[model samples]
Target: MLRRISFYVVIILFFLGGCSDEHGTSPTSFEYEALPAPGNFEITSGSYSLTLSWDYSPENIALAKEFFVYVVDPYQYGGNIYPVDTLTVAEYNTSKGCTFDKLAANMEFCFVVSAVDLSGIEGRRAEAECGTTSAP
Candidate 1:
């Protein structure tokens, strides 16, 4: 009886330990390098307003997850980090790449992307990031 119980316990432990999550995490993003810059990046359609788009390269982009673009207004004095209000697309587009549906016409904004990792240890920031949201 005792032997049977121990065997079952060991098997359960092994199964639990071997389980792998869909999203794998890298211990430290220090080694993770940026993708060779975003492709098909550009300023998309607007009411002559500010719009930005890119491939949003992430160092460790695991399956079943993706990045969210952000914008930073360095001139506005909000530090040097911000999430882009507009632009949402998983795969990169060849022509427009990504698009900001609507925005304040003639406004200024800078944009970037951060990976929403499942592990939640660190936010995946892109190195090929760029922005030019200057007031028009």
Candidate 2:
């Protein structure tokens, strides 16, 4: 029984050792370098809607694969934010913005946009922009 238990332990140790890379780090471990945040974030208000826009430099544009848009209700959530939409580079270039419609009129919403690379890693978020929807 002692020998059997020792053999099982050795097998488990071997399997665990195999799970690491040559660098002695686990295979699941990764090093990430975050991209720069989007710039010139602006918001435009419309009746029951709001549009969020941002800018990126030529180098950043080349690095970014998509943009993640987040929204928050300052009054309700006390500044808690969540992602609402994602825009591909092509889609954003075409419209120059993303619109969220069917919102409560005359209500304020805050937004932040972040650039994501092809590997689906998101970078820092831009400064928040807030706007109130036009009265219906």
Candidate 3:
């Protein structure tokens, strides 16, 4: 009976060792580098809107598959980052500016632009820029 129990324990140990992963991580896990944040951010106030501009270049992008604009409503307490617009690679390649319209006059807004890769991962956010809309 003692010999039989030892043999069973050995068999269990062998199966467990075979099931162990060499990397000790999921096989689907992948590592990707994030893109650099946008630079030279500038803002202009307009009637009920704010215009945002930044320096952009094709060389500035690294592994970025797309771009997006994020906005923050300062008046709303605990304001979360919200996506206001989606930018395509082509649009981002050509235009350096975007506008946030239909906003409350005299209110200030903060903006950030981020790049997303093909894997649906967002990169680092640009420095936040705040601007106030024209008063009525």
Best candidate, TM-score: 2
What are the per-residue Cα lDDT tens digits for candidate 3 across 1-136? Answer: 9999999999999999998767875678677677777788889999998988876556645466788898876667656788988887777667767877888999878988887877778878887889999965
Q: Per-residue lDDT for 93 in model 3?
A: 68
- lDDT by residue (tens digit), candidate 1, 51-131: 555554344444214455666655765447765542223463233345554455555555665544444433545443343
Note the clash tally of each candidate: 4, 0, 0
Residue 96, model 1: lDDT of 33
TM-score (all chains, Cα) for each model: 0.41, 0.72, 0.67
lDDT of 2 by residue, 27-58 (tens): 78677888898888999999999988888887
Q: Candidate order by lDDT, highest to lowest?
A: 2, 3, 1
What's the alpha carbon RMSD for model 1? 11.8
Query: lDDT winner among the candidates?
Result: 2
Question: Candidate 3 — worst ten consecutive residues by lDDT sum?
Answer: 55-64
TM-score of 2: 0.72
Q: Name the lDDT value of residue 58 in candidate 2.
A: 71
